[model samples]
Target: MAFEVFKKSSAPVSTVPSVTIQKRGLISLNRAAYELIGSPEAVELLWDSDRRVVGLRATDLANPDAYPARPQSAQSNRGPILVAGSLFTRYIGLDTTEAKRWVPQVEDGILTLDLKVEGQPVSSNRRGTGESARETK
Candidate 1:
């Protein structure tokens, strides 16, 4: 008489990792991992395009998973939207006046503030003045 032996597969099963994204463009991270990264203004997300990190975006501080699973971080400064420059317009023959009106636009993870002079849109730079001020952050 001959006996047959049944063998089980030896290869380990692979599973997809879980990822969460918020409407405000913040990638979700576990509490422990967030703390381990020094609580930066933004967390780096890696995309497997070229086998390395390709880009960086600011994390939404209001994401629920950020702290205690809250819906928003209105009371915290974890990822505040920093003003890159002074909200003012320098016009020729006119005193420097603060931008009375401004419009904000966000596209592809970039925030652009379109400042206006007395409700009229104007470029940030002075047209004729040689003054060139570059914003540094």
Candidate 2:
């Protein structure tokens, strides 16, 4: 059947003897005799990194009659959240100056602390800064 060729892979392309995608959809063939026509797109999309792939909404049907599978090297990562205030704000403003900081009250638990470059508190409350940054509410 005539499958709209997408980006060519590094592998070989299958050359069908004859194929057609018309109003009746894709049709498969055997050179001399057997020809079977399908009613829908020959290749079904299975999964995508984003909900909309190539700017068009795709489906979860990858292959017909195929079992659930996972692509090689597929993964998702969500880290932590770090609350930061502008440097212009007073450093003490981030300390126990208000009831907002739980670090001062709960020193035994996951209490946040001050971040200073040389000696001044930058008020950068971060955990594994680059690694963990997603906040969950």
Candidate 3:
């Protein structure tokens, strides 16, 4: 009888774009999502109450409605993109009791998340010790 050796995989991480709305209202974007928008430093949030959709449009930092879209930390260049959205969520009356993840669609340079579409619930245990949504600058 011949025994086979166990091997570890070195496959690359998933590049499928996704966005998460944290329990505290922070918006987290996966690497693919970040790159989909050309990696902007700021974004303007647009809400469509009628359609129950949230949109993210890249904009200059000087824009009054611009929100900072920065990497999780300086140490990891490939880390998730974080955006503080506590106020925006509250304004839109979105329930943030649990984190939710959804696939985004881009149209005319705007990334949109349709709340009407069911979102995957994110386990709290998987969340990192990053900035909270309440800490928006």
Candidate 4:
């Protein structure tokens, strides 16, 4: 009585080492506050030593789905974690150059990112080169 739909791909999945954000100094300190927080205004900023990431607790200006909007009875809930600096370096191996590219711009009260993908195309076909798989050097 029920059915599920699925899509398949033969192309090899590729990922970028890192993305560069153009025109905004390397990694703005308030990047997370504007982007993830959904607004430049914040109620409080806490350094969560446990997660090694800053926690940005939202006030009334936060998004409707923000963690703070959850019922107070949900004692097990935690706010969002803002990753940066060594925290990103340790976890995502974010280098200085990469870290510097992580910036967010605020326009008309909305946060946005301007980035471009830079990488080589990956072929999905498994067939050995045009010559032959057993070709000798």
Candidate 5:
């Protein structure tokens, strides 16, 4: 029997829209999600307590309540859209001790993050080891 080597594909990354709420209250929107929201410079964070869903709506940068959607890095505008959302997270009573990734759905010109949906825990970068940082509880 001949041994075959495993090969990795060089295909482009997924286009499915995804959003992540980091442990430090940073909201990150992948390229697909950013484009789905019209790639605005700012967005308004909305909350529905009854449904426990968070909504994001595009708005002008001048809007006082608007959160600026900045590039993940200064060198790349094509990267994820990052928003400082500490106040918003605290207001919504979300547990920020751990990071979570969720797939968002868009409706009526708004992007929504349903808390009811089970989110995948994002691994922490702080650990030098490559192990997942899942909650002990």
Candidate 6:
């Protein structure tokens, strides 16, 4: 399942926006490469666009919203998208800001936000608040 990012309210939280829908039952990229072009004896290495040895990380490119992993040829409907994030943001404070911390919400509707207080370096335990609704101005 994939995660969804939603905006909390000081009054009351509401329905989440349909940004990136998650899917399960697909093979991972690693496994795909092994089946796609790997040898029958050894595992191969992969490089990024920069020609550097890439490592597993939490990035946006491998994410559903950014670049969701495609399903494998074998598993048609029950495959999971084992995605990874990419650190290729050209700007800072874009989504890692106080009012724009994008959290991952499971398909079951369980959201896990990596948020902190505004202007704080993720140290303050202010947590969050609940607002009514944005439509009620």
- How do these models rank on TM-score, best leading? 5, 3, 1, 4, 6, 2
- lDDT of every predicted structure (CA atoms): 0.28, 0.21, 0.83, 0.31, 0.83, 0.27
lDDT tens per residue, model 3, 1-137: 85543221112135878888988799999889987888999999999999999999999999999999999888988878999999999999989998788889998899999999977776543334795433321
- Candidate 1 per-residue lDDT, tens place, 1-137, comes to 75543221111112211122222233333232233333345433323233222222345556532222232356764422222121111111222242222222333653222222232222222234555333210
Whose TM-score is greatest here? 5
TM-scores of all candidate predictions against the true structure? 0.23, 0.15, 0.80, 0.22, 0.81, 0.18
Worst 10 residues of 2 by lDDT: 101-110
Candidate 2 residues 1-65, lDDT tens each?
Answer: 64443322211123322221111111112221011212122222122223211011111346543
Worst 10 residues of 5 by lDDT: 4-13
Q: Candidate 4, residues 11-126: lDDT per residue as tens digits? A: 21222112122122122223233335443333232343443333334456355433222221335322222222243233433234322222333334433333232222222224
lDDT of 1: 0.28
Error of 6 at 128 (Å): 44
User: Candidate 6: what lDDT?
Assistant: 0.27
Model 2 gets an lDDT of 0.21
TM-score pick, better of 3 and 6: 3
Worst 10 residues of 6 by lDDT: 18-27
> What's the ranking of the predictions by lDDT, best on top?
3, 5, 4, 1, 6, 2
**Worst lDDT 10-window in candidate 3:** 4-13
lDDT minimum window of 10 residues, candidate 1 = 83-92
RMSD to truth, every model: 24.8, 28.2, 8.8, 17.5, 6.0, 16.1
TM-score of 5: 0.81
